[model samples]
Target chain A: MIGAGVLWWLSAPDDITRPYAADVTPDIQAGALVFAAGGCASCHAAPEAKGDAKLHLAGGLAFDSDFGTFYAPNISSDAAAGIGTWTLEDFARAVTKGVSPQGRHYYPAFPYTAYARMTPQDVADLHAYMATLPADATPSKPHDVGFPFNIRRSVGLWKFMFSDTRDVLTDAQTPQIARGRYLVEGLSHCGECHTPRNALGALDRNAWLSGAANPSGKGRIPGITPAQLDWSEADLIEYLTSGFTPDYDSAGGKMADVVANLAQLPEADRAAIAAYLKALP
Target chain B: MTGFTKTILGTGLCAALIASAGFAASHSSVTNKAVAARHAQMQMIGYHTGVLGAIAKGEMEYDSAMVDAAATNLRELAKLDGTTMWVAGTEQGATDGSRAKAEIWSDAAGFAQKFTDLENAASAMIGAADAAAVGAAMGGIGGSCKGCHQDYRGPKS
Candidate 1:
């Protein structure tokens, strides 16, 4: 029995260990840029409206979903209150597998299911960038959710139902397109906003890019699929560069802030983004 | 016809259709086009003026004279007829590939207020072309741009 237990312990997968290699610093930096593009700070950061901007990623943003009011948790580097003690493997597992450092299940509100397609290098870069932030010692806030949601283990079932743990696949036939795909599907996570959700809040893969209501309770995020946006490559490029649509109109609300960041990026990267978005099926 | 020939013919037809659609889509009200062109020109002027103003104030040092000249041009550009440029359905120009949100249309008054704010700020910059006051001008102009952009621009990613 002792020998069997030892064998089981040795064979049992450690939730934290990830299949990652070093020497991916450049890719990691690029991934950090991609993370910025994805606007992770906008949602994950504590709300500035309530006058506490210093909280950083000590998440307190409330996201009201059909499941319930889901408050974001503190993801800082605090040893006691945050993930300060977490290993790179632990961070990767949380981001890629939706498993907390302590092996607890994380709610889908954390976006790990979509982030699962991210390259390990990108994840590492994001991890590195996150590590540089000032550690806040705020304790993790409990979810206001009731019933089954209150039981954190329920996320295991949620994972089984909706998680797609595949890395972003790139085709050699179109390297630029492939880069765009990786950037969009992985770090950018565009589908999180544009793709509609089902009753279970899982993305409806078949009707991908068809447009959906914003999860933040703002206006509907329009579909940018070729069929819907009908934008030329130049149009997309201009829009990305200047935040103006080809029709000379400006985007509004959160999108405006997003454009501001994109506008500051290198033109070549913007063109690549335009090219990729146009090619989306 | 052979398969290659059929494919070529189909692609050619599709290309023609797309071209026609693009052409039709390109058409806009002549008046609106003029207004949009003027607005775009003003935007460029505002951008340059801000840069120049920064230089003049010693906060930045790129080209003070050139920036001052650009600010003059912007003052002139802002004087053009902008009556219909920011109207509903006219917020975006044919060449402007912006994701102009519906709020611009739904809340036209507030949107127009931003334009007025921009014009006022730009006009003020021209009056105070002195190095000492350039910083203030920069702030005013930037404030207007931010005011409009905050509510209207799309996400960059």
Candidate 2:
């Protein structure tokens, strides 16, 4: 029995293993669309005001915080400067496990908590798309973060406290509701902006979707609760489609860019997002 | 004699009716042209000031003197009665405009408030050519513009 158990454990596929070959067909292409709907570029790429087309995802974008300055790293596939040496498994592990190839923990600044719920297939598809991009060999800049944060190993404790390791699976609920849940928990990454963080930089689940001060300090990231905004599904859909609410108000700053991307998505997906946001507690 | 007399009378009536229609059409066309010209003038003023205000505020800084001249021209253009120029049915048809939102018509009062805010702020900037004061006024103008644009302008992807 002990020998059989060991053999089974050895043969069993791990969380990051692909059971089949990578799907690079149209379904994966559709997954790419879903990835865009999730707004990956908004944070990963350098910040520009509305409508400036530039791709600089070899991340040097800086964020100022009470703790210290954190610089996002180059995610390009360059072997030396970027993730070029990273295999599909390495990419999946980083996205789902929040651990780098060197066994170092990545800060939640990368939003891997939300990405943890992403389907392996979707993650693999994203990896495939990223691999096809031109490799930028820009050297990763060291984070200027101070004291406790500079100690990268400390992030393991942070992950233990905050990260959700479960993959999102659809229950026998209404399709619309399930879709909304998938989007909110996985791709949309609403909590990154909406949920308040504790002192240790972990999200306060009690204040989930309760709105938080904008990290950039420009303004408040508004609460999406039905109580706060009183927005109907139609209103939310229109806002997502045109960047204008039914009440004649429009989103600005980062949200404007979000809306622009959302507009490109199919109407049903936007509706699903609206449904999800409206159902939030 | 009876048929010939009736034919001549019918022709005369048709000619008179055509002449009257032509005269009315010409008159309406001229009126429309005038209204269009006035609307264009107001739009140009708004556009020019918007660009100039960006420069004055240091959000953008290009040729200062050229922007100053543009501001001056905007002030001259603003002399026209904007309310009258943007006639109800005609405003939607204006071109080279991405700033105007469909909500402008749906929520006229709110839209007017934003427009008034913009006009007042812009006029203040134009009145005081001092760079610092212009920057302050530019903030007000930018606020109003952004307030409206946020709600109305289509997303820029």
Candidate 3:
């Protein structure tokens, strides 16, 4: 029993000793773009928030899953209730490693698995931008998950088993496609919803962007594969910017939020996403 | 009553009876009809929104007459009560091709407010001075459509 406990303790991720460069001044403007791509407000902002209010990041949205109901916590700069006091390194580990400042494992619901691929510079930039947003002091609501899933340590084991860091697409033909690959697989985390998941809730890398049963229940999230979505590259870019399908049906559900974020990005970025998707076999 | 009027009323009654009888086994004809009506209205809204969008994107030339007609059509559509078309049991799983989430019926007031939002936005479009004005108003109009669809509409089945 003693040896097993020791193993469990040792299995917990080591404290992040790697320091974020202290002298490198982050570009807040670029960080804003990174924030838009990340769609941080989609989950962290209050459900009723709109327009500029989305920047608050007070975090009361509920994400229902098979394991349990997980609430997006307060990520605003509130000194006590939020991450206002966190250093850039602390924020980086939480974003990339899924470990908290106190060294606890966060549930995979945070999508740190996808964020693990982000460049450290981008992480630092994002931290700087978030620091500029308005702070909210709303306390986070506790998740309603039942054990043994409630035991946070189990996530460490799951991460060890399923957290694959290999890039999804290796044969990018251009720098544009490479940028698309990074945004899609890393910061945008499009596969989080668009891809099917195994019983354990980890994304099925084999089925990347091929669609899944909508976790919110009652309908399937449509696949965006070449076979499923035969839209032209131009069509894809327009839809991302305008939310209008070729059929003139407007986007609904969570996709509207995604469209709002994508619309803020340059047309070139949307074009890049289009090119990458078209390139997918 | 005139002979023509009587004949028309008789035909309508016969058709209604036939429809009810054909669907009597599952007794979902009323629900199906309601869902169909709502879907038709939504398609009309989409059509007008597309017209305005094309003008805004410069894909279609901005003619004042065309703009007025489309904006008026949108305003009238938004003003429609549509209460009967969104009846209970007409949610996504209850009817075919609905894509109407249960929240439409459960949170009836919120759903109604979305229509009001559309109405106000369409009113703004109608009052816009020119093509540039309409283009400026398109964001709010589109946002109102999305506001409801985001919360109340389901994925395409």
Candidate 4:
């Protein structure tokens, strides 16, 4: 029994395949909105890409943290330098499982733990939208981490401890809150940054979105769980859409990108997000 | 030996208390004024940016006059010399009630350049609003704000 269990643990599956229909047409327009809602441009766009040029996902932004500097890689459709040659199955695995086409483990900075909760249909739609973007040939940059953090295989252990493919809210009475949970817990990946992490770096799920110290050591990521945050649903919606607090202060810091993404979503979607936030325990 | 040591220690503690009272009196009142001024300046900037941002996001319909007025105010705010309002030692971790980082003082030139960029963006926005294209001009303004904020300010503590 012990030998059998060891083999099972050692041979954890590398891929969870979701087959693509050979000719199933995806809604490119809907996928475009999901791209914005996921805030891909805010991080993946070339640093100086302004105006409509922001659509180019050549990816060179560096996220400096206490762990080390993480450079966002090029996810463009250029075959030589990007994911152009990847199959739909490979893209789905990368997004949800944080695995590469070559069977390498991806750093959680990619936030697949949250993306794991995304519907496979949306993943296919997103793949369709990305196909239309202008693909640049910029090569990916290496991370600047040191010591144990650099080991890719160790990520599987971390994944085993923290990664969950389950929905954040399995039971919901209202459709609005349910939709909000999908966006927040999945595509938006708000909890990835907002929730505090354990000593081992996995999210302290108990704290949820109650905020934590920023990994950069420069500032704190303020708590947003209902216990610490008291914004009403209307105020929360306004904040999401306008980047303004009820006190008239404009949002600063990383939240600006989040607001920009939320601004693109419809008023009803924004309301749903607010409803979900308000309902969080 | 013990009596002498106790008397000296008692006198030393009393003198320390008086010295602290004097030090507290000297810094507290003066420090509050600069902090308050900085807060007021930020609020003024927020007031102008709030309206322009609302219009830019299509949350409110374009009213040329409101757009022009808010844009004008923000340009002027950007131009205002905040040297006095941003007095030294008013940063986060140094003191309460401020999120500005100490780096703002050390890198005054960098901060000034960001301010100039904001000024330039606002001026361009003013021209855009005049031509009924404030929406197009909003990106420059947002980018300018982000450029400075990414470096100088600490997190919302």
What is the full ranking by DockQ, best candidate first? 3, 4, 1, 2
| Model 3 ranges with Cα > 4 A deviation | A1-10, A14-17, B1-31, B127-134
Winner on lDDT (1 vs 3): 3
| Candidates arranged by TM-score, highest first | 3, 4, 1, 2
**lDDT of every predicted structure (CA atoms):** 0.62, 0.61, 0.82, 0.75
**What is the docking quality class of candidate 2?**
incorrect
Residue-wise lDDT of candidate 3 within A38-127, one digit each (tens)?
999999999879889999999989999999999999999899989999999899889988999998889888988888888877888999
Q: What is residue A89's positional error in candidate 1, in angstroms? A: 0.7
Give per-residue CA lDDT, model 1, range A192-261, as digits (tens). 7778999878877776667887765544688878888888887777667555453234455666556655
Better of 3 and 4 by lDDT: 3
Question: What TM-score does each of the candidates earn?
Answer: 0.63, 0.59, 0.87, 0.77
DockQ for candidate 2, please give it.
0.05
Question: Candidate 2, residue B102: CA error in Å?
Answer: 29
Model 2 lDDT per residue over A1-281, tens place: 99867544443322445542355332456655665766766665654423333234566778777668778787766778777777777887788767787767777788888887777667767777666555666677777788888877667656655676453333414577667777776777777777778877777766767788778554467777777778789878867865544322346656765776777788888888788767665
Q: Judged by TM-score, which candidate is best?
A: 3
**TM-score of model 4 (first chain only):** 0.92
DockQ of each: 0.12, 0.05, 0.27, 0.17
Cα RMSD (angstroms) for every candidate in the order listed = 11.9, 18.3, 8.3, 13.1
Model 4, residue B69: displacement in angstroms?
A: 8.7
Question: Evaluated with lDDT, which candidate comes out highest?
Answer: 3
Model 2: residues with Cα > 4 Å off, grouped in runs:
A1-28, A49-53, A165-173, B1-157
Looking at candidate 3 chain A, the ten consecutive residues that score lowest on lDDT are A14-23
Error of 4 at B59 (Å): 14
Interface RMSD of 2: 16.1
Q: What DockQ number belongs to candidate 4? A: 0.17
